[model samples]
Target: MSAERQLTVLSREWCHLCHDLIEALKPLQAEFGFGLQVVDVDADEALEARWNELVPVLLEGEVEICHHFLDEGAVRAHFQRIG
Candidate 1:
């Protein structure tokens, strides 16, 4: 198997949905073995502008896997495809 990759979550501290998504992804991380990174959109001007309304965006590289919520099926499929 290839080494695990990093998954990015575009988020802000105040977003409960964002936090929920992160919590949901934890089990997926354990199963698929990928690193999770949570980025605060408010910390960067462009990221804030681009993703302000789209908090809880999940990405593998530049490809957005899910947004607003954690799609467990899609996440499994993505890892399966990449695996």
Candidate 2:
């Protein structure tokens, strides 16, 4: 698979729902064989500042799908488009 196929997830420490988001993505991750990076927004001051309120955001490269929750259909469509 190409590097762009990887998935980036922006999350924050102390966020309870981040786990939910990750769990929701399990199937897609396995199917696409995409690397999942959970970026702690708190670690980057700027990112934390910008996306603090938008935790649990899913991204494929720079393409953002849903924030605050996993939209399975939307995410699946995104992966299909990418593939």
Candidate no. 2 TM-score: 0.86
Q: Worst lDDT window (10 residues) for model 1?
A: 1-10
lDDT string, candidate 2, 2-31, tens digits: 544678889876787888999888987777
Q: In model 2, what lDDT does residue 50 have?
A: 73
RMSD per model, one decimal: 1.4, 1.7
lDDT of 2 at 56: 82
Report the C-alpha displacement of residue 43, candidate 2, in angstroms.
0.8
In candidate 1 the C-alpha lDDT for residue 58 amounts to 97
Model 1 residue 63 CA deviation (Å) reads 0.6
What stretches of model 2 exceed 4 Å from their correct place?
1-4
